[model samples]
Target chain A: MLTLFYILSAITLGTAFLTILSKNPIHSAIYLVLCFFSIAGHYLMFNAQFLFIVHIIVYSGAIMILMLFTIMLMNLNKADEKNKPILSRIAAVVAFCLVALVLLATFIKSQPVINEYKVSGQDFQSIKVLGQVLLNNYMVPFEFASVLLLVSMIGAVLLSKKEHINN
Target chain B: MDQAIIIEKGIFIVVIFAITMLFAMYETLAERKIAAWFQDRVGPNRAGKGGILQPLADGLKLFSKEEFFPNTENRFLFIAGPAISMTTALMTSAVIPWGDKLTLFGRDVILQATDINIGMLYVFGVLSVGVYGIMIGGWASNNKFSLMGAMRASSQMISYEVAMGLAIICLVMMTGTLSLGEIAAGQHGWRWNVLYQPVGFIIFLVCSFAETNRTPFDLAECEAELIGGYHTEYSSMKMGFYLFAEYASMFISSTILAVLYFGAYNYPGMDWVESVAGANIANIIGIFVLFAKICFFIFFYMWVRWTIPRFRYDQLMKLGWKMLIPLAIANIIVTGIIILLADQNL
Candidate 1:
C-alpha cells in the first residue's frame, strides 16, 4: 500500500509539473488531464472509489474538456507568451524560495509525528454513507452549491443572448 | 489473489476483449448487409460465403493502406485521440453482467470482469471521457471542418448527457443501487424496470441515440455538411480505429441498454430452466440471451441509421436541451412521487 501511494504521488506530482511546463495550451490541458487522472488514482489507492469516480468525471471528463474547448476556440496553440521582466522573474524566484523555506521549516518543526496510517474498518466513503452525510449534515451547503451553479448557468445564457433592435 | 483466480480473471478479460473486437468487426459487416438488404441489393458477396470473411478482408485492406498523418502540430494528441476512444469503448464492458454465475470445478464463477460498487457511474465517467477522443483528433487535425465537427460532437454529447443522467437517476431511484449487477439481479424473471419506468426508458433511449451520435443526432459527422466531419483528415488504421471505436461503443451502449432497461440475461422461465437443465447450461443460455438482446440493439441502431434522416444541428440541440432534459426531469419527479406513495401504502 505504501509503495502504491508513493508511485501514485510521484505520478501526480510529475504530471502537475508537466501541466505547467508544457508550452502549447493543448499540451498543457492534456497534461492537466493526466494530473487529474493521477489524483483520481490516488483517491482509488486510498479506497475512496466514489470520490475517485466523481473526481474523474468532474475534472478529467467535464472540466478538462471545457478547458480544451476554450483553448482550441481561442487558437491558443502558439508558444508566444511574453517572458516576464527580469525584476519580476527575480522577485518570483525569491518568493518561491521563501515559500520553500517556510515549508521546510514547518516540516522540520513537525518531524516528531509518526507517519502511520490507521485503516478505518467502516465504509465511510461508500456511496450510501456519503449520501447520508451529504443529505443530513452538508445539505445546506450542497443546495447552495446547486443554486450557485444554476445562477451561473442562467447568467451565461443571459450574457450570450442577442439583443433585438426595433426599427 | 490465488493463481487459479488470477488465471480465471485473465481468461475472462481476454474473452471479453475478444468478444468485443469480434462483435465490432461483424457489426461493420452487419451494417453493410442490413443496409444492402434494406436497399434491395446483395452486399459484399465476394469475400467468402455470404461475406462472412468481409471484415477480415476489410481489416487487411485497412492495415495495408498508407498511414497518412496530416501536417498538424500536435501529432501526439492526434494519435492519442483514437487510442483513447478505442480504450474507453472497450473499458465499459467490464462492469456489465454478462450472465449469472456458472458453477465449475466445485466453485461458482461470476461471468463479469469486475462488479464495482459504482458501475453505472464508472460507465458514465468513461463515456464522458470519450468526447476527448474526437475533440483532440479534430483539433490536432487543424482543419476548420474537423474542429467544427468536434465542437458539435462535444456540445451534443454534453447536452444529451444531462438528460441521460436524469433518466438514469430515475432508474437508480427505482433499483436503489448503483451497481449494474445488483440492478440486473433485481430484475429477475420478467420484472424489468422498463415496465415501471416507461417514460424514463424512452428518455434514456433517445438520449442514448444522441450520445452514440447515431442517425437523427449524428450532426457531428453529417457528411453532407462537414465533409466526413471530425475524421476528415484521418486515414488508414487511424480512421479505422475511429470507426471501429464507434461500433464498439455502439455494442457497449446496446449492452448497457439491455442490462439496464431490458431484462439483461434474464428470460422467461429462467428459474425452471436452471432447475431442469442444470445451472451451467442455464447460465450458458442466459449468456446467449444477453447477446441476443445486445444484437437486437445493434440491429436497432442500424435500422434507425438507415431509416431516419440526420437531424439539423438546431433541431438536435433543441431536442436534447428543450425536449429530452425536461422530460427526463419530469420522469424523475414522477418516479419520486410514485415511490413515496408506494412507501406510504406499504
Candidate 2:
C-alpha cells in the first residue's frame, strides 16, 4: 500500500513539474492531464471510488479538454516567450515564499487535528455516506457552491451572447 | 485479492479483450454489409463464401499497408492519438456486467471484469476522456482540416455529454444505484428502466449517437468537408486503429444501452427457465439474451447510419444544447417528482 502511494505521489509530482518545464504549451497541457490522472489514482488508492471518478470526470476529462482547446487555438510560439524582468522575477519569488510560509503556518496550526485523526473502521468514503454528509452537515456550503457555479455559467452565456441593434 | 480470484480476473479480462476486438472487427463487415443492403448492392462476397472473412481480409490489408507518416510538428502525439483512442474504447468494457454469475467448479464467478460500485460513472469518465484521442491526433497532424475535425469532435462531445449525463441522472434516480451489475439485476424479468424512463432513453440514445460520432452527428469526420477528418494524415494500421476504436465504442455503447434501459440478460419467463432448467443453463441463456439485445442496438446504429444524412455543424450544436438538454432536464424533474410522491405514499 505504501509503495503504491509513493509511486502515485512520484507520478503526480513528476508530471506537475514536467507541466511547468515543458516548452510546448500542448506538451505542458498533456503533462497537466497526467498530473490530474495521477491525483485521481491517489483518490482511488484511498478506496474513495466516488471521489476518484468525479475527480477524473471533472478535471482530467472536462477541464483539461477546455484547456487543451485554448492551447491549441492560441498557436503559441516558443520564441515569443521572452525572459521575465528581474523585478517581476524577484516579486514572483517573494510572493511564492509568502504563500509557502502561510501554508506552513496553517499546517503547523492544524498539527493537533492531524494528530487526533484515527482510522475508524467506518464507511465514510462511500457515495452514500459522502452524499449524506454533503446534503446534511455541509448543506449550506454545498448549496452556495452550486449557486456560485450557476452564476459563472450564466455569466459565460451572457458574455458570449451577441446583441443586435437597428439604427 | 485471493490468488484464485486474481487468476479468474486476469482470464476474464483477456477474454473480454478478445471479445471486444473480435466484435469490433466484425462490426466493420457488419457495417459494410448493412450499408450495401440499404443501397441494394452486393457487399464483399469474395472472402470465404459470403464475405464472412472480409474483416480478416481488411485487417490483413491494413496491417500490410505502408506506414506513411506526414511531416508533423509532433510525431509522438500523432502516434499516441490512435493508441489513446483504442485504450479508452476498451477500458469501458471492464465495468460492464455482461451476464450474471456462473458456477465453475463449485465457485461463483461474476461475468464482469470488476463490479465497481461506481461502474456507470467509471464508464462515463472514460468516455469523456475519449475526446483527447481525436483532439491530439488532429492537432498533431498540423493540418487545417484535421484541426477543424478535432475541434468539431471536441465541441460536439462536450455539448452532448451534458444532456447524456442528465438523461443518465434520471435513470440513476429511478434505479437508486450506479453499479451496472445492480442496475442490471434491478431490471430482472422484463421490468426494464425503459418502461419507466422512455424520454431519458431516447435522449441517451441520441447522445450516444453523437458520442460515438455516428451518422447524423458525424460532422467531425464528414468526407465532404474535412477529408478524412482527424485521421487524414494517418495511414496503415494507425488509421485502422481509429476506425476500430469507433466500432469498439459503438459496441460498448450498445452494451451500455442494453444494460441500462433494456433488460440486460433479463427476459420475460426467465424465472420459469431458471426454475426449470437450473441456474447454470438459465444464466447462460441470459448471456445470449443480452448479446441479442446488443446485436439489435448495433443493427439500429447501422440502420440509422445508412438512412439519415449528417447534420450541419450549427444544427448539431443547437440540437445538442437546445433540444436534448432541456428535454433531459425535464425528464429528470418529472422522475424526481414521481420518486418523491412514491416515497410519500409509502
What lDDT score belongs to each candidate, Candidate 1 first?
A: 0.90, 0.92
Best prediction by TM-score? 2
The digit string of per-residue lDDT tens for model 2 on B184-282 reads: 999999799899999999999999999999998998889998998888989999999999999999999999999999999999999999999999999
DockQ score of each predicted structure, in the order shown: 0.72, 0.86
Residue B217 error for model 2, in Å? 0.6
- What's the CA RMSD for each of the models? 3.8, 2.3
- Chain A vs. true chain A, TM-score per model, equals 0.72, 0.79
The TM-scores, one per candidate, come to: 0.92, 0.95
Q: Over 4 Å off in model 1, which ranges?
A: A77-121, A162-167
Given candidate 2, what's the lDDT at residue A146? 100
How far does residue B57 in candidate 1 sit from its true spot (Å)? 0.6
Cα lDDT tens digits, model 1, B188-281, are 8899888988998888888889888888788889888899889999999999999999999999999999999998999889999989989899
What are the per-residue Cα lDDT tens digits for candidate 1 across A1-167? 89988888898899889888877778889888988998999889868899999998999889899988898888853575677899999999999999999999998888431222124455676798779878997999999999999999998777667332321
